[model samples]
Target: MHLILLLSGLSFQFSHGLQPQFVFFQTPKTWSEAQNICREQCFDLATTHDMREMETLLEVVKDKYDDAVWIGLSKGKTRRWRWSLADDDFYKEGERSYLLWRSITDDNCAVFSNGKLNMYSCETNKYSVCFDATKQGADQYILNTQRMVWTAARDFCRAHYTDLTSLRNDAEYQIVQQVANGSEVYVGLFRDPWEWSDQTDSSFRYWNPDMLVRTDSTQTCVAMLKVNSGKWGDRACTETHPFVCNCIVKKLSFIKLRISPQDSMLDLSNPSVQADILEQMSQKLRSYNKTAGFHLKWRKQSDGRVFTKEP
Candidate 1:
């Protein structure tokens, strides 16, 4: 038998798995205000990772509010394009998410289409551009110089050196372009959508075709308009509208967790044991959503005990 402890908005229950509970706020508020309210009232603004989540989220907000309700999705001006293999801690101020697209398009979204910068459907298989960090200093780009499918080239690069290269600024782009010799080679730049307010990475795209090409630069945040079949669009963060918040059940489920017999001597209440458990749990949670940016820890009781046996 497995012990599954589920905590959902101050309620304790047994569940097969953690299920997100959506809370809709009918009152109008700006994106930031809505986020604050969501944190105050629920867990945070809902985070969607795929079409399934987007569809389910739409159903929750359908017909509840005429205006667009803010979820967690937004085009944050501060944080934009990130490197695929680079650690987030290595990013310096104003050194990441940098983009200067070759083409000027109305839509904020962009992707490589027909070997040129277009919009959306971010994933593509093409030649690889690998960055070699082992060379030291900033200049670590390793140009493959050979055209191959993205997967194969990535494997080849990893086998011999590091994985695909990532371009964060115009300088990197220029370097890659020069190395490509006027041919379109694949860098790590991708048009990922639906980043959560909590900084979780999710590729959920629920955009209305009409929602493309945001006119106002100030409107960096997004909301799901009830009339547009719950499709999303960029709106001013100051815009007031009803919003949707999602409460994630922080569930620590032990469904037949195999413990190594060699480690059976330690007591469960040991601080070191608890720390190790928390660390392992954090790693597991990361695999579920690497961008969630959450830290797992043991909760304390009134008497300062980290845990207690069930009666």
Candidate 2:
């Protein structure tokens, strides 16, 4: 009898829905390169179908890597978003959700942009993420010095590392600033009024503080880490100085969840039970969505008090 009961329990466990496990690559690679790498290794680029999986992946890689890598999700030729590796037709089902990984609309493909750890289109030129056999590692900060046109430098960085050294955040910016103050290496700090690249449809610009200086119509380029006080100055991009490149480190973890048998008891059969289960599941999903996987407790609607219900 005990053996039969054990077998039945095992069967029940298998019958419940199970969450898929996902892996991530932290090394930057171009979209195609990333896909090729993943294919060669018998692994597909990472994709997140729900918020729980996304959070689990983020926590896993939070320490192992820093720079973001490419994932399997993309907006394909049909302009209909689809998972690059999965055959399922793209169906959002009108559910509003938050994206834990980076996503780009125009390019239809996604890349992890350096600094911001956000998504971008594959067609868009930016740094890429790559992976190896044992464990995929993050980008390492590298410094390169070169002489080229402003356009050429941008191109070079796109081909090689992350963009011409955009600051990742306030902490990173301060670090770069301190380094420039000491060695006077030219950073990405530029002086030209930021303009949109013709390739992109939007006209958005983000310039570092005091990085732009308007001296004359001839000042077409910008320079960083001036010799005296490490202030920004205008110079031709062609001017040569040692440049900085960043290698990002990212940590990734794959988590899989299997619904408990007791939890599954919330009848998926009867219409009323199905509706109630769906309503509860929706509420739980909404709670998960709000924090992007951060822990949150349920609260009362009237008094804003946290409460737990007993089954």
- Candidate 1, residue 70: CA error in Å? 1.0
TM-score of 2: 0.22
lDDT of 2 at 100: 29
TM-score of each: 0.45, 0.22
Which candidate gets the maximum lDDT versus the true structure?
1
Model 1 per-residue lDDT tens digits across residues 25-48: 888988888888776666677776
Backbone clashes counted, model 1: 4
Predicted structure with the largest TM-score when compared to the true one = 1
lDDT of 1: 0.58
Q: After superposition, which runs of candidate 2 have C-alpha atoms over 4 Å from their true positions?
A: 1-18, 81-311
RMSD of 2: 21.1
- Report the poorest 10 consecutive residues by lDDT, candidate 1: 7-16
